[model samples]
Target: MVFCIRRAYRSEQAGFRAGKFLTNPTKAGRGHVNNLRYRSSTRKKVSLLLMLRSSARILLLSQAASSSFITSSSPVSRLQSAQFRTSARTMSEMTPVFTKDACPPAGPYSQAIKANGQIFVSGQIPADVNGNLIEGNIGQKTEQCCKNIAAVLEAAGSSIQKTVKVNIFLTNMADFAEMNETYAKWFAHKPARSCVAVAQLPKGVPVEIEAIALQ
Candidate 1:
């Protein structure tokens, strides 16, 4: 009976050891499963954070591109034109009109006419208002003609400084130097001009000048 009891006790010890071994394996497997689940959860979170950051960056870039397009396509904001009738009338109101009576023509023509910011002066000879021809050399004739043109330009609300174009007719081409010397004194700005020598002039004048001046 002592032998049998020892054997039974050994058997019981063996069974307990077997059960502990099985339990330890199951616990270890459960811990491995839990670790795998935690690892998966961490990976998913990292992926979601990366995706969110990428989405935010894309959205910011899109918004920036849209803002740039809007600014580039926008039109200018300043007023293109002003109300001329209400703003100012100096250009229109101050324009002068010279009639036949104001400056009697030396020949058969009007003195000057103002239209559209320009003064058109007829060809003026070396003659006074009373239709008397001026005498002397080419210098004297050029001075008289320039003075007549000045008067007509002034009557038309213009001046020698504003003269844009001029045409001079001289009976003698040799007198060009003398005429130009006197003409330079009247128009310091030196307007665009075309000088031609003609065989004859009205009233046998030495020089005649026509000018177009800006108001």
Candidate 2:
């Protein structure tokens, strides 16, 4: 009886050891599969995060490039548009002014004519406001003539400094020195001038002066 009991106990111990060995391998395999699945999921999540970060960086760079392009293009477009308009306006404003009541011609000539943005005033004798001659010596007559020219120039929207050219007609060559002294005082800009003694002048005036002034 004692031997049989010992044999039974030994047999049960052996069976328990065999069952433990077989079940341990299946449990280990299941645990390894679960670990592999977890690792794969973590790797996929990390890859998605990296792709998102790259896409975000590219989007930011694209926006920055677009902003830079707009910033550079605006000033160039404004300059080109301004240049075109200025050129057109400059061309259009170059036309001359001519009117019927521009003070009747003193001697078969226009009193003040405009061309090329300049006023060409005819030689003004010592003439009254009514275009009639005022008779006097060189000094007195020159003052009156200058006054007349001033009136015409004012009417034409110009002034003495703007005078580009001047022509002084003298009856007597002896008065040239005195006339020049007085003319110099009036015209400080010193426009291009030509003084000549003519055979005769209208209304027998001693001096007649004409000027061309810019607008």
Candidate 3:
């Protein structure tokens, strides 16, 4: 059997000769057992080293990819965070403007509200602090409205000169010329404006004006 032949190869006195054991063994036969063990061990060590190198390369690549991904996304994340903070500040910064110098509100609204570096003045009619209507000509009524708007702006940490936009409502279009002349005097900077005729105004005032301005 092949097993019996291989067993004989390990014996000191055996040599390959057909199926018989020779009396004198060759040099290959003498050292075959130890040489086979050394070669097998060396192959195992080489295989182990190759597997370790492959694993190390995979680990390094994974770490490098993760670092690159983080680097690419960092700026976008910071930008989004900054935008969110700005939006929050804008939402939370609204403050009501109130001063005894301005005509009081006729209803439930504030005279003005300041937010995000701007002031929003509500429509002002010809009225005093007690909401009493002022009977006046078209030009005088327009002047009173502008004065109320100015007072509101000052309360909101801004000034009439800072006005950026204006809206005026009139009960009659015939008074447009008078209103415009009075308006030109108050808003020397000539802020953008729109004027329209309305059916009625609060307190029967002939003119009502609202303004928006920088704070």
Off by over 4 Å in 3: 1-80
Candidate 1 residue runs with Cα over 4 Å from true position: 1-96, 99-103
* Per-residue lDDT of candidate 1, residues 53-87 (tens digit): 56767877998898887666544312222345433
- lDDT values of the candidates? 0.73, 0.72, 0.80
Better of 1 and 3 by TM-score: 3
lDDT for 146 in candidate 3 is 87
Better model by lDDT, 1 or 2?
Answer: 1
lDDT, residue 64, model 1 = 87
What's the TM for model 3?
Answer: 0.64
Per model, how many backbone clashes are there?
A: 0, 0, 0
**What global local distance difference test value does model 3 have?**
0.80
lDDT of 3 by residue, 1-215 (tens): 33443343343222222113322223377455555554566456556555665676787799889888876678887788889999999989988899888788878999998888899999999887777777779998888888889888887778999999999999999999988999999999999999999999886778899999998
lDDT (Cα, tens digit) per residue for candidate 2, span 27-76:
65776576555556655655655566567678779988988887667888
Our tally of clashes for model 2 stands at 0
